[model samples]
Target chain A: MARLVTLVESGGPGVREVASALAPYAGHAQVIGLTGSPGVGKSTTTTALVAAYRREGKKVGVLAIDPSSPFSGGAILGDRIRMQEHATDPGVYIRSMSSRGHLGGLSATTPQAVRVLDGVGCDVILVETVGVGQAEVDIASLADTTLVLLAPGMGDGIQAVKAGILEIADVFVINKADRDGADHTLRDIRSMMALVTREPNEWRQPIVKTVAHKTEGLEELLEAIGKHHSWLAEHGELQRRRTARASAEITAIALGLLRARLDVTDELASAVAAGEMDPYAAADRLLG
Target chain B: MARLVTLVESGGPGVREVASALAPYAGHAQVIGLTGSPGVGKSTTTTALVAAYRREGKKVGVLAIDPSSPFSGGAILGDRIRMQEHATDPGVYIRSMSSRGHLGGLSATTPQAVRVLDGVGCDVILVETVGVGQAEVDIASLADTTLVLLAPGMGDGIQAVKAGILEIADVFVINKADRDGADHTLRDIRSMMALVTREPNEWRQPIVKTVAHKTEGLEELLEAIGKHHSWLAEHGELQRRRTARASAEITAIALGLLRARLDVTDELASAVAAGEMDPYAAADRLLG
Candidate 1:
């Protein structure tokens, strides 16, 4: 399993070989994305969710992508320490991916890693990311069920709304529910949802309140996730979402390869800089 | 000026024509990028800087890119209101670009808009953005001088360090300098900067403190920007930076056009799903 993940991360020729071998076994596991701002207890909620899934006698895998602290990898280390409860559980697998400053690299590599886990007999895969930036939002395209976690008194309601997190959330988990203003946060999300005019047949995103540190509300959150999964399957949205994911994954890879192929000549760049050629014309020439 | 900006933002076929026509008149403006977290008074600082530049009898253009509030365009509205001092000035042009949920689209469109501003007899161009994500970081490539603003008590020091904002900031502004912990924030940034190992000949990044709301320290901030501009020109870094920007812009455009051309078929995606083909192989087939 470690070797397969390494293959995917390396993004080398081996990725193709490993992916082809695992392709047949993929799509069996339910992929869930869990994301929220920092200090929102995403790690605690993820650990709770993993334990709950394991209670059902199912294998689980986690792919934690941390864009923060690329130099120290501190956040991922803290997460591993906190998740040690599952360290001895053979049914659980965990991996952490840190950003290496390559543009679009994380989004390109994550789906392949998830595919590997799916192929390796994990009954469930949870992709946990800090929902702070564009790369994190890209996870929405990959997961069958996306859970946007929010916490009370964090000013998260406004931040989440501003960041457009409301659009991607299938289940909104207001963690730290026991904290003051949790109900206010819940109301904020509900009011925001009320603003959207959805078709009657459309799935209404459910808000699940959780004090994740105490493991309270785990079952309800899980139930919401399960319900969303079922709704997706019933509406054939599962296939549509997966198809879109595959399309994006393929396009990202193709573009990465094309980038590797086309080296912008210094002369061309100098021409553009010298104001003798426009960037659009330069792009056209380079593409040719 | 507004029509040219519209043409660039539209990304229509006429963009190339407009770009080529304006190419000869470009490369004259000194583009400065100012970015920081929300509530850091970026608008206030931007307004002050525009006023300062105008006092020097120079034409200025401001492009405020807002990733948040794309739907309502509220940030731009706020900026216009704050910058109403220059509303009647024919020498100053202000435009706002909102994120339309397209990946790398802002980075793709911004340089064209900057080119338009540069073409239209603007001596100074200010590109203001919320320093939150990858698109904001990409602004470093487009600007001659990048100023990262941080306010006291904002926890921006740690956020800046985590986001690797240190590398991109050509100048750091400790805005709201009269607030408590202003010195602490300045010390934090200074300490962080002290850890960096720079060559003797390299231009060190300067930190400027400003009470932008009071219009204090505006001249010093402007002086820092001028110093950076002069340093860039003397070191030939200006040409080098523009060359790098053109390269990235060209690559992004080429990749975008390629994405439009490659259609991922359902059969191809299903083949990958069924383990009949790897994604790399699938991409190859699609490219072929």
Candidate 2:
């Protein structure tokens, strides 16, 4: 599994072949994505969740996507330290993925990683990432169910972070529930949700509170996720989501193939470089 | 000029016409990009630099890229407050571009913005961006010379921000140098530069300290930029960089065209979405 994931990480014809071989056995695992701002106990919550799933006698896979920013530490070891309790558990698989710098927004091969874990014996895969903004949105697009985590005493920080993340979250988990101002944060989220207009039959994103370090409220969190899963199946939303996800996969793959076909020869590039021809004109010639 | 930039921002056939119309007169302007972490006096320094250049009766264009991250305030008004000195000058054109979220790193149309500025008779175009991650690196690739700003007493924050930025920076401007530990920051940059092996004739990245608010050391900064520009010309690096930049532009254009050629019928997407066929196979059908 690790070897296949490494191939997916490197990403080329080999990974494509691996993906093709695995496609027959894939699409069985539940893909759950967790995202939140730094200092919100995301890693702790991910570790606790892994234990919860493993207790059910099911295999679990954790893909911790370390932020690609230079400001972030090389934190693969740090994540291992936190997940040490699951170190010896054969039922749990944890991997930290980091992007090559300047590759643009989150790694392109993340969906492939999830596909790899699904094709293995894992029944549940948790895709956890750090930071808000575009990264969180991308996570939501890739996951079967997306959980957006927050904590108390963040004050206006919560207000700031909630802007674009409100729609993409499937479950809202206010971690560190024992901390001060937990009630205030809950009230703020309630008010914000009130502002969002939703259809009467739409799935209302439930808010759950937990102190993830102590594994408090693990049962309640599991109940919320299970209810969401059932709701997805009943409303035919599961198939819709899978179809949308597959469409995105197909589109991304098509774009890659198109990029490979771009015929920017040295002579054309040199002409644009020399200002003797503009890029649009040069591209025109190359395309012809 | 504003209309053309708008067309470029929309990114389609209109921009193609606009670019082709302007390409004949482009390639004369010097594109200088400034990037740094927030609060490093980037805007103030840019304001000061604009005034200094305007003193020589040169037309200048400032393109301030408001970061796409949710954490940043919508600061187009803030940037304008600092550059109000140039507000009345017809020769100075300043535009603040805020990107649509999840649109990816920086903006794909940034080069087209530069092309518009150059064709409109701007002698020097300043592309300014905030943040210390992939955004900074993208700015460096788009500009002839990239300036990285640092403030005194940023402490470990300075250490963290300098990782990927050091190699791309053609000039290091230590803004807020009036504060304490200015010399300390200067030394850190010098030692860091020392670690990078360079040929004897290679242009050394010069460190210039400035209290941007007070407009101290403006002449030295300009001189350093002038020297770097001269060195780039003498070494034939300018042509090489432009060719690489044009190659990227041409490839981006070609990709856009190839994407239009993809024949993803609803049946193919439906097959992948329904799980009857995998995405890679669907992509192959679309490409066929």
DockQ of candidate 1 compared with the true complex: 0.44
What is the C-alpha lDDT profile of model 1 across B107-145, one tens digit per residue?
657888899999989999999987755545677888999
TM-scores of chain B, in order: 0.93, 0.88
Interface RMSD of each: 3.4, 4.7
User: For residues A159-226, could you state the per-residue lDDT of candidate 1 as single tens digits?
Assistant: 34554677789999999999999999899898888889999999999999999989998889989999
- For model 2, how does the per-residue alpha-carbon lDDT over B1-288 read when each residue is reduced to its tens digit? 777777786675677777777877877898899987657888899999898889988899998876433434333366777788899999899887653333345536677788899988999999898753456666777889999898887635312434556677999999999889899889989888888899899878999989888989888999999999998899998877777778877776666666566656667666765546767788888777
Candidate 1: which stretches are off by over 4 Å? Answer: A68-78, A81-90, A99-106, A154-163, B69-88, B100-105, B156-163
lDDT by residue for model 2 over A30-98, one digit each (tens)? Answer: 889898866688889999889888888889998887643433333345666778889889888888775
Docking class of 1: acceptable
- The DockQ scores of all candidates, in the order shown, are 0.44, 0.37
lDDT of each: 0.81, 0.76
